[model samples]
Target: GPKVLQIPSHQIIDMGQMVTLNCDPVSNHLYFYWYKQILGQQMEFLVNFYNGKVMEKSKLFKDQFSVERPDGSYFTLKIQPTALEDSAVYFCASSVAGLSNERLFFGHGTKLSVL
Candidate 1:
């Protein structure tokens, strides 16, 4: 199966620091997405990017969180000044659609613990 690969399954960071999560998706896929999930809570949409621009961003997307796909490569999320509430499992996903039509393929997820 062609699934997204999230590097470094777990991260422990201090409050008010920075961390980056990496995702490797299907080589030909164009759209990239990130979802955040906390224990006992439903997954919350974070951000979606396409064609080198951010298509949408949820309220959960904090100012400290940054996303990029440099050189059309890996989809990455960088969270600086991580807060305790930011400790959650981030699932990386990809779809082959532009706006109205899309199907998500989700990865296992990378768990981040901000202490």
Candidate 2:
């Protein structure tokens, strides 16, 4: 079975600092996605990436957030100048296929806190 792994299950940071969350996606999977959920809100899509380029990004992906795959390694999400509003559970998901109908496997999530 395939799985996605997220590191530093919890992160506490200052409001103006930078944070880079790590995600190890299932091997051989080509599509990766990032999603965020506030304490009581529904999960919102942030961005999707494939073939070394961004496939789609929602408005929720602010200028401070970025995603990348360096040397086919684990997918990563970096947020600079973190804000209090950025506190949320960030999830990393991967799918074998890039189709909308494909099933995604999600990591437990990295809970981020900004103070």
Candidate 3:
């Protein structure tokens, strides 16, 4: 797997606050995704992006959550007025093509702790 870097390895925020998780995806990779893993739970897909649009997102992607990559900068996931349920480890992944190719590379993950 390619090495993807996630900034601020850990984050602690209170309920109803906002938090942004940043990912420096693989430079050559185009498609990007975000997955969440609660402690002791399975990793669940949240959203995927390509070009400049969100290709797909799971039901877990709440209305308060948004994803964007402006001017080819870092791919970011923003959660506003986050709930305690949002506390999880967010993993960023990227692939040159789509997930069908099975070439996804993942970051170490940003641990978000919502109190």
For candidate 3, write residues 1-115 as lDDT tens digits: 4689999899999999999999999999899999999999999999999999999999999999999999999999999989999999999999998858467899999999999
Q: Report the C-alpha lDDT of model 1 over 1-115, residue by residue, as the tens digit.
A: 7788998899888999999999997777889999999998999999999888888999999899999999977899999889999999999999877556667888889999999
| Each prediction's RMSD to truth | 1.2, 0.8, 1.1
Candidate 1 vs candidate 2, TM-score winner? 2
Which clashing pairs does model 1 show? 17-81
Poorest 10 consecutive residues of model 3 by lDDT?
A: 96-105
Which runs in model 2 stand beyond 4 Å of their true positions? none
RMSD to the native, candidate 2? 0.8
Candidate 2's displacement at residue 48, Å, is 0.2
The top-ranked prediction according to TM-score is: 2
Cα lDDT, all candidates: 0.90, 0.95, 0.95
Candidate 2 local lDDT, 1-115, one digit each (tens)? 7889999899999999999999999998999999999999999999999988899999999999999999999799999989999999999999987887889999999999999
Q: Among all windows of ten consecutive residues in candidate 2, which has the lowest summed lDDT?
A: 94-103
Error of 3 at 91 (Å): 0.2
Q: Which scores better on TM-score, 2 or 3?
A: 2
